[model samples]
Target: MKSYEEINEKIRAGRAVVVTAEEVIAIAKDIGVKEAARKIDVVTTGTFGIMCSSGAFLNFWHTKPKMKMQRVWLDDVPAYGGIAAVDCYLGATELPSYDPCNSHYPGSFRHGGGHVIEDLIAGKEIKLRAEAYGTDCYPLRSYEQNITLKDVREAFIFSPRNCYQNYNVATNCGAETVYTYMGVLKPHMGNIHYSSAGQLSPLLNDPYYRSIGIGTHIFLGGGEGFVAWPGTQHAPFDPRNERGIPLGGAGTLAVIGDMKQMDARFIRGVSLTGYGVSLMVGIGIPIPILDEDMLYYTTVEDADIQAPLCDYGKEGYPTGEPCVIGSLNYAELKSGEVDFQGKKIRTAPLSSYTKAVEIAETLKQWIVSGRFQLGQPSQLLPGGGSPDRKED
Candidate 1:
């Protein structure tokens, strides 16, 4: 069995032939799978989309009286304070202020933890406040200060769930418009919005988790990180096609890495009109050409991928088994139109395709330059045991 260590040595010595997922698709078709897989050493996969489950953990230094923070706020956005002294989890969608929750204020709340996270990553000053009852050994009761990502000893995004395998295309067939986390759906089936980079998504590329096991080294938040666990809501048992690819959402990833090491270009805080705030996260994973089966899967294309067109405007919608309007290939979806209700419905992609390609190219350069060396996962994910932690 060829190991990741061997591949890293090859990459370091400039003997590895790396290609982006899109490029490999054409190469595989032209040269045939056996020859293309024989020549290609690594295939880079990428995705750039809104991940609301994202959040960051900030570990602060001990205060003057050595206070253990019981209440915490960063840039006016509340973070979970019960974890431990000076440690908190700032969720991406958590609003800076509570929603007014009145008829006039419906769905207007915006600024939240995601913005603060982006600012900190940008190396800008951020306000922090915490309150704690005085203790005998750790006496300080409360604290207020302005800090930056540089000021902290530890700062990393510990996203519990990200990079879904596939997603539905949203449409509105009702008389009025509807707002959803999937993006706004215009009334009368006016527009269709979908995400996931079709063949470029990591999980989608290795649909059965054949090569994307827990310890796989990946491009994360603009820096190198590993898949920590099977992300929450993971349904590995979901039905799959003959090729083992799930027709819709399947595997997810729990990833963690230094926020300070990430690039702002691939990390942005976004406000999704009626959907509140979220992080536009960029991620890339390189699938090693371990075998012919892996190679064949990586060659999958947008035309081969499929997702259901679920009506977001319908009342049963999300919770119930959505009445799939229809299934369509990403190539059809990306053509900027979908056939629906006897009319052509325009389409839009919520995920940024340009950034997704940039991530893949960046990872490719790292390998070609011998700068991004791959690591053997200490163990496999979730069941593989916890990963080793280190400070950047």
Candidate 2:
């Protein structure tokens, strides 16, 4: 079996064979996993999509009079200022105070916390305003200033949930059109929307969480990051196919990295029509070929990955209860059309497959050029299974 140390040594010496997840699939198909494992050292996987649970932590340093911020606003988007003297957490889904959400039919939410984040990463100045109760030690009652990402003493993305292993395909079955996070779902199932890079998704490549765990280094928003923990609501013990990949939103990652090193292209702010604003972040993970089994797992194709179809209307996702219509594989979904109940419907991918490919290739280049080194996880994720094992 190949060890991480061995692969890292090769990477340093510029001898480790690295390939994107898509590329390795063909290689494994041609030469088989055992032979491919002997020839390959690492497989890079990626996903780029909307992750609403994303946010950033910023330490704006102390104001002139040292204010303990009780409430904070960045570009009118509220932030959680309960952390420290000058620390705040800006969530992607946080809307502006003036945002009249759904008061008049469908709201046109054009700006929010996500936009503020993008501006900061873009090296643009953002208006920062905070208020506090005057204390003897720190007497400042209010503070307002313009700050960029460079102005913050510390700034890093602390996304609580991202890179869903597998997610649902959303459609509308109600009488009227609905504007949901899945996008504007047409009534009577006129359209379908699905996110995830299918086989190129990081968790899909490492289905069992064997190689992806806490402390594992990854490419995040064009910079390096690490898996902080298993994401919120992480239910790894879900129904799976023979390949051990989850059938629905199962495994997720809580990741973090320096926001200063991030790129504006990968970290974009999205205003989802009637829905609130959210962040679309890019993430990529490199799985070291520790053995034949690890190499084999990376060979999963789009046909093997399945997503549950659910209605996004009142009878479905809105009532806190789900009505699972059925399941569809990625191969059929990616073909731009799908047949549901004998009716052909158009399918659109919210996630960017092209960007995912770029992320994977970029990570592969990093490893090959000895610019990136893989880090072993200090702890495995919550639930565990084997892709090679048969479900009893």
Candidate 2: give the clashing pairs.
none
How does model 2 fare in lDDT? Answer: 0.92
For candidate 1, the TM-score is 0.93
Per-residue alpha-carbon lDDT of candidate 2 for residues 1-392, written as tens digits (9 for 90 to 100): 99889999999999999999999989988998889999999999999999989999999888887889999999999999998889999999999989998786588888998888889999999999999998998899998998888889999999999999999999999988999999999999999999999999999999999889999999999899999999998888889898887899999999999999999889899988778899999999999999998998899999999999999986899888867999999999999999999999999999999999999999999999999999999987887445544434
In the predicted model 1, the residue pairs found to clash are: none
Distance from true location, Cα of 27 in model 1, Å:
0.7
Give lDDT: candidate 2, residue 358.
94
Task: Give per-residue lDDT, candidate 2, residue 352.
Answer: 98
TM-score of each: 0.93, 0.97
lDDT: which candidate is best? 2
Q: What's the C-alpha lDDT at position 323 in model 2? A: 78
Cα RMSDs, all models: 4.7, 1.8
